[model samples]
Target: MTRNKLRLAIIGAGPAGIYAADILLKSERHFDVSIDLFDHLPAPYGLVRYGVAPDHPRIKGIITALREVLDRGDIRIFGNVRFGEDLTLDDLKRHYNAVIFATGAVRDASLNIPGIDLEGSYGAADFVSWYDGHPDYPREWPLEAQSVAVIGNGNVALDVSRILAKHPEDLLPTEIPANVYEGLQRSPVTDVHVFGRRGPTSVKFTPLELRELGELRDVDMIVHDEDFDYDDAARAAVAGNKQVLVIDKVLQQWRQREVGSASRRLHLHFFAKPVEVVGDEHGQVAAFRWERTAPDGEGGVVGTGEIREIPVQALYRAVGYYGSPLPGIPFDKRLGVIPNHEGQVLIRDKESGKSRQMYGVYCTGWIKRGPVGLIGHTKSDAMETIKHVINDLGNWWRPESPSEESVVELLESRGIRWTDLDGWHRLDEHEQALGAAEERARIKVVPRDEMVSISRGEV
Candidate 1:
């Protein structure tokens, strides 16, 4: 690397971070550049590997494209390195010219309703992590419930309901871990009720995702015809959005289908808003109570006086994902995002009493904008952030030591065991070999210690 080379650090290896690196490398900049993509997990592809449902391999296929970007040899990968603990903003400033934070939202957003603290109440994010064999989550999940209630209308809510209703044997073909398979096998669930406040036309689910629910093996989907009674606002929305029209059509087809004798049943209930999660004597979830809702003629719904209660042992909330505050970032608590002006981080100056740009610091993905769109939306979000990054290149802070060797020395002096691209390839091969023995796609390594050990070549 030359003295004029710009050393960049991206603090996530997810879609957002990878896309940013790709754009930066492809940009026609005057100076040479070197990028280091960092992730806390030993593996890359953050959400695509840990957040997406395993059965949906099409969504997971995005990993192949991301893999090609890292394989281009212009970017370096630093896996299993935690920000704030392993390195700070000052540490990055000492080695890199600029830093981009792409750490995405992973925690479940709060709904702020009554009885939300009861036992047997789980967040869909945690459930997804467990089922997807995330190394950070617990290996065993309690699935002893016979009837479960899932609240939300997004693809995540549908994923939770479908996974609960689908048989364990049906998931064997996917890359589901052995522990998840065993945990789901013990589930006695026969009914999964999914509730949404809005009508079918206003649902957040993608048309393809919504249609996949109807094709699950041995699981019957039940949709009430009354739930499709849309108001003028919903009708107008469906008329304008082709996706909504397709969703409406698919839902209508399911509503007209004759009920089958499948052992497990998944009921989609619209026009219902959860009010409380009632608990039983043992402090576990006993029943779920919700109020009937009607369209408010504004693409929203208003709760009616009518209330309904259903007996259920477990409840999963999939309202949305919220970003966590980074150690040295200015975060907006209300929006669960880092405060920024067009991807340039904004900080209030103590002397001026006005918000000003934090030079050389940028944000992308859910941390820059709220978590709302699909994975494909991340590319455009990265482009916006990279535009600001390129604009600020003339004013970027020159590091005291910008060489790649300095970064390696810094991590080594701190005794941080970081994995590189070759390490990741070894772990990938290990997983594939494990999967080959089982005749599956790939068996995931569930334990964090094992992941670190494998990546570090200690096993």
Candidate 2:
């Protein structure tokens, strides 16, 4: 007697989706499973490739582990195949035993403040995508600003601040694309103001990231002495959390340093909550107006009615990322995640008039849980989702057409140009060869058409 094989389809080839495939394949449940990872782009490793800052090669190193998983050959990668346009939820249900959506958030979460729509005001997500050489974003970025303001205190805010203040030549050692390098070279930015709504102890930045700000060459890290005012709650947080302690220590050291004669400066402002983005006559960002905040004794802050204004040529909001709704998934617009309970998707029951699980469909990563944690957090999240999947394995709907070849046949019938694992290898070699000529790690292909062409072996 032959054992039955399970067919799984995972959308979005990012860390979350890939990690799920890895866990499912490595499980000791004694069931044979085949996973087909699908991605809209012509490459895998979604955020690791597109969202991470080019200068942080250490963070990008996570790709090495992800690459090993893909190279295992047990899992199949279908690149350049979109979830909605190329294939639908119905199509997935027809061919796979179960579906997992790991499409992580790519857009910036809105900051609903006045003047946020000003011409010079932009989302940090767009800037990050441009600098990371994402294929979908435009090649050129408006970098003529002399001074900029970055709202938020997370790693992304740091990335935006560092990219704005650092000398363009310093980024050459990394795998920054030609377009991004050129854009950075043209930047006239001299000062970067980073604002946090809470005190220093409540900042979201990790210690290593905070320390790196002070280490940038020719950029003075300036932390105002007044910003160090922490209440009892803030002090308690610093004592309770090791990361907060490290961040506080790093900021204190920066505060004690005498202002160095650097061409560029990065100013850290705590307890400053942006109330409005002031615009000039032409409707371009001219300055930022923020209200002072004080600890509310609950690890949060309250406005103190004291406002201050800082002149800036541009503003970038890096508050957070939000996921978009898939074609047939139940999405919580407010939370920016799929409506789920323990990884099982929830939908409104027509008869019962209550929320219930949508059998056989699941979600993981930022799409399941709101985008909050780092890449390391994705592993544990995936484990939780996978456990739910395993528990529902017995009840998964049986498909009329479950063979792996059925998916290929469907794509062919739809005339969709999909690339396989071999295509990714070809594109990978092409990029590495380009990098070899330049004496760098790898130069990313910046254009979508070019990437598709290279992946298809046309280039």
Instruction: Give the Å shift of residue 101 in candidate 1.
Output: 0.1
lDDT tens per residue, model 2, 149-241: 999999999999998998989888889999899988988999999999988988788899888888899999988878777778878888998
Please report, in order, the local distance difference test score of every candidate based on alpha carbons.
0.90, 0.90
Q: What is the Å distance of residue 434 in model 2 from its true position?
A: 1.4
What TM-score should be assigned to candidate 2? 0.97
Model 1, position 153, has a per-residue lDDT of 95
Instruction: Give the 10-residue window scoring lowest on summed lDDT in candidate 2.
Output: 1-10
